[model samples]
Target: MASSSSSSSSLNFTVRRCEPELVPPAIPTPHEVKLLSDIDDQDGLRFHVPMVQIYRKKESMAEKDPVQVIRQALSQTLVFYYPFAGRLREGPHRKLMVDCTGEGVMFIEADADVTLDQFGDSLQPPFPCYQELQYEVPGSQEITNTPLLLVQVTRLKCGGFFLAIRLNHTMCDGPGYQQFLSAWAEMARGATKPSIAPVWRRELLMARDPPRITCNHREYEQVPDTVKGTVTPNQDDMVQRSFFFGPLDIAALRRLIPQHLRHCTTFDLITACLWRCRTKALQIEADEDVRMMCVVNARGQFNSPLPVGYYGNGFAYPAAVTTAGKLCGKPFGYAVELINKVKGEMTEEYLQSVADLMVMKGRCLFTTVRSCIVSHLARFNIREVDFGWGEGVYAGVAQAGGGSFPGISFFCSAKNGKGEEGIVFPICLPAAAMERFSQEFNHMLRNKNQPQTTSATLIMSNL
Candidate 1:
């Protein structure tokens, strides 16, 4: 099958192999195993995170076939991360486990007729037929029958290519998926061993006794099994936009904060600014309780810490909550302090207590409409995944139209040809509110001396 747009075109290439294989071929039988931790158990349901990477052509890679190399490396890399090649199944006690059946990942090859330059500068506000770049699987199928991972490598007319990957969130989190990509790239470079060897120790995160409930976990409230009188919004009115925050832009925002709070991390400041702007854009009620939900990595929080390559969901969703009036009306430092306090609360005991509480309740915590979920991908070196080609010109998550939640944002580190450091924010909002959001966000960044708005509105529209 093939799909095309005015700027870019793609043709799907048939794949030959789909069975998982072990490189060494000496390990024990790949039997079905239970996911020991409740953290993994809660997310075992089928949900996928899609990512796309756009790489400019390297002259040396012009003649080499990327498809063959990627396929070979993927096959070898699966020997270590073999669970990715397996299926999700309901184990005893209604828990989800991996059916390690050696069923391989879905791999597809594609060709794009457009040059990299013609494909537009931002991967957000995705081009028409962007869905063609991502591998597709039937949505109605049982979770056990679906492939855990799907990859599509599209070669462009300019010799550059786009690599799109969709991984089942039930099987791994962001860090885990990055590890798999890094390992595969290493194999593609003909390295015998990956830089970090993977460790499967899910038992280490087992739930504690008596289900300890410590500090107020207001961020993670349980949803009732049934609901009535809930209204659904019009999905068609939603729009996804990407904003670029250059080094200078970020520094300006930092300068606005008090000197005492200046020591806050970049993630802290950027997220604080976004939370305030997003809340204002929605024109939410002053008294409405709003939240900034962030996914915290628990790997390093534990006393011993998880193994470097423990591939599972080792993260916690910690949120900072305040009424809209308080959050927007307060100084920027207030939000930063709230976020920092939440970060400090993610100690080993807190995580253990959370796991215990989840086990006792038999349900995962849920979010509400007032919550703005923010994920930071700046730390992950996704741009460094080199498979014969030079580093990618741009790489980030794939954002589809119409399915966007009102206040979700992802921050990523980006660089252009000039090597300037920049942060890219992919934000989703109701189409009607985008203009107002652009105005407010830009105003927050403007200097007090500047009498007028700069090119912020123009930049936002182009996004």
Candidate 2:
């Protein structure tokens, strides 16, 4: 057994490939957990956000004979996460991949980052990294999970080690993921009783082999790209940056919008305001077209309910529109109008398009949809995703930016009262353009006529 042990403690960890003999008899995927709950499927409605926490160990965690113990624990845990072991195969769901194996899912990757810890470097950050092969684990030396996750750990030029964790959206949301990670951490610490033993019943999430096409599904589907333009590899055209916006800024923006304008939500204010800034930066023509695509959840959108364990891909992209000139010229309220109007279209029709398109070509449409130019507004409550360690310092969306989308941004709530909400965005314009864009954004915040800024910026450094 191959294992790495931390020098300061008796606890050691072993990393090994999952073998069939170690797996337990499989169960069906859970497709139904509940018919319906009070969870609202609306624009401002909040969902659990997923996160990967990194811990640095000053002392070595490698053990001489820890492989067996780690393997035993992995075996037990494997039975619970069997669905992941299944491979992605050819099916109506193009997002999934399946080789010769009847099953179609597997763990993406997990590794160590010693160099990050020893050198005392800050968390490197969210970047474009992925492994082409589905089942193999990636090391720090290579990019892994292009659209998924990439974790790198190296023995820094200094002493300690870094631990990086990558998680895919399909697996679980933030709250659900935190629960799973907490349990794993406990197990790693040698806790006798796991906090939340996983409930692995595939039937809870399994759909009919052919799947039933209903209005709900139809509303979420989009035309697969196989029939559309081909996607050439995108060169790096943008710079990814992490910006912090505080409470005062958000509050001011809220104040700018008229009370009659529904008091202007966070997303509403930011989208409208940024569209103004982007127009200035890119110098888009007044009559030129621009649209903001806000993602909507369809999990409980239907009149009928779904199972609690019904965790497959369950989201749709809806577009909000504005003319570059109008968006730039309008008062904050006018921008808010675009956000509200566009958000309203996240109906059954939009969702069905996504589903209908996927099943038509089976596997050809998945990559096509991912390559399109679309800006997404991901709004969520970051505080709720607490593990045993407590709530997170910051929470924000991580995506593969650059040539993929010229304009993409994410909004996350500020942790505690630290002030500004987090913004994860990619700026693909030239230096002068980026400078102009930043100026316009600041002007909106400082302008007493605009809505108030929410919190203070925490970490505004570029990625």
Candidate 3:
């Protein structure tokens, strides 16, 4: 993990947790082994992903106990989403499958001394008291033979509460996980079933017989253990901070773009800015390679569209590589174009080729060599989850980021008290580099009054 993360330290506190317990499906599920799609058990995604959601009490929910309601709802919801109740097991050749043991998922009920408002007005990532809010049971940390999901509901003094959940990555991707969450919320509202039933056709993504490696997957290149130009810092030296971009901030970025290249999306522009600014902050050697990746969800990007309810790791991170100096020195459009090209290349052929590459290379890890990966969770409808307590003030990854590798971030949808929707993402780096990064970032978010180049001027002109 990255040396340090932003903790909910503003108001120091701890949670009083009851003994954790497993909640099984309301009804028995099929007892059988289900082979996961090759993409599901890949080396890059074999860990648990945690999320934190904050629900402000609504008048209608004043009398109801959210913990009790949600606990029952999860049990009922698991009957339909039973795969999540099963444990992951290794088959021959290191392939993974669900044991369908019906062991159920872990759940905890806890209470906190602080009120939700006391935590802070802004409920976003890098939240305070992260470990306490998202408690993990001991002996339940392994990737296999453990509950696929662990949930903790911490009640606050003000009626508003927190819902924290940790899920195994191989079981689902962002969209799939969100889908399951929506179902759980629906059940909490007394729905007989999920609006869209899940489809477990993992076989749909099976690797082609006689797997063939077609494209040069530079993102997975086997390089020296010590990667170049990465924004790595000592454990005690890192600072995690989140940046927000609203309509006005985005307009500022767009104005810098040339008309022809204005077609670039918010994703492209922001990613371009972050890569450039981050590269400059690192002050990496001019000749060393620096890579920026955009994680593209392949739901419909493949030859055949994945079914509406299909939930698995159906995604890929295509990298845009260049020298640190080149990326930092290039016009903003250059970086945007690089990102668009790699993202556009994620067609059916590209996905299939990746599946083949995975098996062929013994499921290699994504290149950690000076690589920065950014993903957007807005499309996943993370905030739409309403567990009968009205919508949550915040709903997204528990921690914006800190992974085995450095340079990880997530762009999530957020709204203020005024209901102004915007994008917020968190990134962690050394204290000194963070200062430099913030300086460069402010320039990118420049207003008309701030004298500056548009896309840094020459940056987007070529695209």
Candidate 4:
């Protein structure tokens, strides 16, 4: 039945035998490591919300041999399963292994008429299709009884189709995901095999036994009062949407920030600008405390170290700071300064603080940290998620649009420098606030001294 969808052309693909890579040889980190049994404590600390969108021109040949294209595509895309290495003890249950079920990829169907505009329309402004998948997960979890890949098909008025790929972020970062896709595309194009094989053994990242928490870990964990929250923003309080910021504009803004502030790199500059924009958009009070959260990959942060191919969640949260009033009034350059100062806090002491708190306080720490925070920016490598269709225009998470205090956001880039140059940021804020925020954001991009295009806009809605 699946084959019937494809044309009779030479194009053909299939999900043959694919297995997870062998665990790499590496020392294990003992003291700081959490066994599968201890994972409950890290529950919400990590979320698996990775997804991709593929755009392809419609062709008569494709329709004639739907399966051919799909199969070819599937063949090109590589898939694998990473099993939980450590044993989990729960009462009588001796050893329970955790694997990302064979379901790690999904396909969404859409026709040509569903331009990015319409897709955005369907999502409804701030709320975008990308963000709606969270609701789809629980239902999927019920259907598959585990984290599974999801695919959707939609017929558009035009001939082309849009494919949305959803995967559990826990499995891989954007780059890793792209590598798998590129391999699949090659296969779909009739390649005998993928260009590069995937690496999955967690042993590669295992730290020396008796893992020692490095001091740098402490700096990234510290945060502020007003920025922290007791409860994370719920669905009612937040919506989701995707926004594009052209690279040229970002580059222009980058030139504007003082030299002292630019040293921290891309994340610092973009985030600092955003902090200023969000503050201006919301017209936040100068005295009110505001914070911006950034994801820190913990793979190499610890003193002991982690195993290579450690495919589990290895991320930490650090933040930039500002008062509502200060952020709103400052020039973009000043915001960069704030961003630099706060990021400096991510030091060994901070890591230790977080480790001690986690070990001493246990699960409660996760909650304390999650609540006392507002907005999260995970700069995971997005450009790497390439399926056979070449590189992606952009890849990343959509924000939960309309929200109360402490908004959460995500940033990623396109496969190539094709679509937008800078990061694809999904922001969620109130309508009134975003309008104002958009203005300042544009102004920063179009500074006469360093002018840039205003390609990104906030289409507020309840997708």
TM-score of each: 0.87, 0.60, 0.92, 0.65
Model 2's number of clashes is 115
Per-residue lDDT over 1-463 for candidate 3, one digit per residue giving the tens place of the 0 to 100 score: 0111223435666577888899999999988899898788888788777777889878888899999999999999999999888989997777899999888999999887778778664476666657777776889989889999999998888898999998888899889988899999999999999998998999887788999978777888866644335555445677777777777677888777678788888888888888888888877888888888788989977556998899877888888889887887777778888987888767677778888887777777887767788887877777878899877788887664533355777777887545668777777777677788888988777766755432211100000
lDDT per residue as tens, model 4, 348-446: 445444543444333233322222232232344443433334443344443442122235455655322244355556666554555666777777777
Better model by lDDT: candidate 2 vs candidate 4: 4
Regions of model 3 farther than 4 Å from truth: 1-9, 225-228, 231-234, 402-404, 416-419, 448-463
Rank by TM-score, descending? 3, 1, 4, 2
Per-residue lDDT, model 1, residue 121, is 53
Runs of candidate 2 exceeding 4 Å displacement = 1-51, 55-78, 91-163, 167-237, 360-389, 395-406, 414-430, 448-463
Clashes of 4: 82
> What root-mean-square deviation over C-alphas does model 2 reach?
9.3
Steric clashes per prediction: 0, 115, 10, 82
- Per-residue lDDT of 1-463 in model 1, one digit per residue for the tens? 5444432233223222223222221233376665747777663224566777777788877777777778788888877777777777776555677877776777777776666666455444344356666646455134555777778888777778778887676677778877888898998889876899988788776686656777567667643322221112354565556777766667767777788887788888888888888778878778777778776778877779998888787876677888889988988788877876777767777777667766776746445556766777767878777877868777767762222343456676676334566777766666667677787788788888644433221222222
Using lDDT as the yardstick, the better of models 1 and 2 is 1
Query: How do the residues 182-286 of candidate 2 rate in per-residue lDDT, one tens digit apiece?
Result: 554455456654556554332333333464444333223353433112223342333334344555666666766777886556666666766566667767656
